[model samples]
Target: MDEVEVVVAHSERATLRVGDVFLKVDTDQARIDVEVEVMTLAPVPTPEVLWRKPPVLALAAVPGTTLGSLGGPSTGSPAAWAAAGATIRKLHDAPLPPLRGRSGRSIAALTAELDDECELLVTNGLLPADLVTRNRQIAETALRPWTPAFTHGDLQIAHVFVEGDEVTGIIDWSEAGQGDALSDLATFTLGHEEHLDDVLAGYGTDVDLDVIHAWWSLRSLLAIRWLNEHGFDPFAPGCEVDVLRSRM
Candidate 1:
């Protein structure tokens, strides 16, 4: 290896890029197992798996810049965002991957979790009580039942890679499983609301905006605390906090 570049580092896992290979290090074996299996099953392009050993998975790097960064404008064209939407649609249509744990949860469970997170936010003064309550109310609309689809689970903009208006690949499959298709859409468009039309046009289907908005609130509320603890600031300009406030 010539030199190593840290791609992402937090408490749970760290990814490093050296030469043309990316090394993902995580103490959790089950997460690695899911990543490998989900990549094999995913319909869209993904980084090629070079090899894997305990606590380390080496992957051939995908040749493209990431689609965008959180809290920042994407240089990718509208066409590129649309291409990503099409890719996500294809993934949702693929066969579901088998996993050892629960791929999704019931509405009751999601609601319970949301309630707990909201309480924590309020109690800790992490957010204004009114803001948290309003977002929580907005999030409730997404708890309705839906047919399970193959979902990427964490389709943040940074996970999608593109080159010349084409989506080359998506990275990070640890959370892939059967879940709400809208969740992927909501996640991808979280901080990039301006591109929603492009993505929806390429999705080639009608989606309920209310459900998408609900998911936006749900995901942001659930993730804000953990993101902060992990050295990510969801409250940064145009990030998750902004996404939530946009609802009000």
Candidate 2:
């Protein structure tokens, strides 16, 4: 029997890899439903659904490794990064899914949440007050009105795979929804400023650099607390903390 490798485990969900199959166990069935539904609707390559039972959804592992990860040295050549960007552009251009669930959580609601999180980050000494304040200022632009697009809400670098210069698959669709397209780009390129140009090379020339920058601040600020409580270190070098400080 093949050994089961733990892919990711957190309070909300856990994913296990046994040989070529990945078993996802989520606490909320709705999240699993969303993942499955979006995976079916998304135009990009996704893991094949093997089976699903309640909170456990099984999928065949996609070929190729991830593009790279935050806080780590980037892998693959500029071409590979551009390929990933092209893949993102394809997803963004695809027909919008019905659920506006994760990404477009409403500007007013997100603004309120960002303010609350900033206050907590400062009050609890979770982050330096100056750091929080500066990021909050930078994050303001992300709150402004913007056109919507089909988005992979948590389009982290690790979620995208590339073999050579070909993007093989994109995983993790629980957060997929209609939202500001910049947020997707921001999430993918967060902590990877040097690669932004490379990504945009394939993504497009019409992108708003400022909004993407704002999203970098907004996403990093919003993630610190949750990441800390989840036993993850947001302050790790090249991680969320560094991402926030880079904006200052």
Q: Which candidate should be chosen as best, given TM-score against the real structure?
A: 2
The lDDT values for all models are 0.88, 0.92
List where candidate 1 sits over 4 angstroms from the true fold.
100-103
* Candidate 2 lDDT by residue in tens digits, 1-248: 99999988899899999999999999798889889999999999999999988879999999999867999988889999999999999999999899885669889999999999999999999899999999999999989887779999999999998988999999999999888899999999998889999999999999989989999999988999999998899999999999998878
Q: Residue-wise lDDT of candidate 1 within 29-49, one digit each (tens)?
A: 989989989899888999999
In angstroms, how far off is 222's CA in candidate 1?
0.3
Whole-model lDDT, model 2: 0.92
Candidate 1, 207: how far from true, in Å?
1.0
What ranges in model 2 sit over 4 Å off? Answer: none
- Candidate 2: lDDT of 85? 91
Task: Tell me how far the alpha carbon of residue 55 in candidate 2 is from the true structure, in angstroms, after superposition.
Answer: 1.3
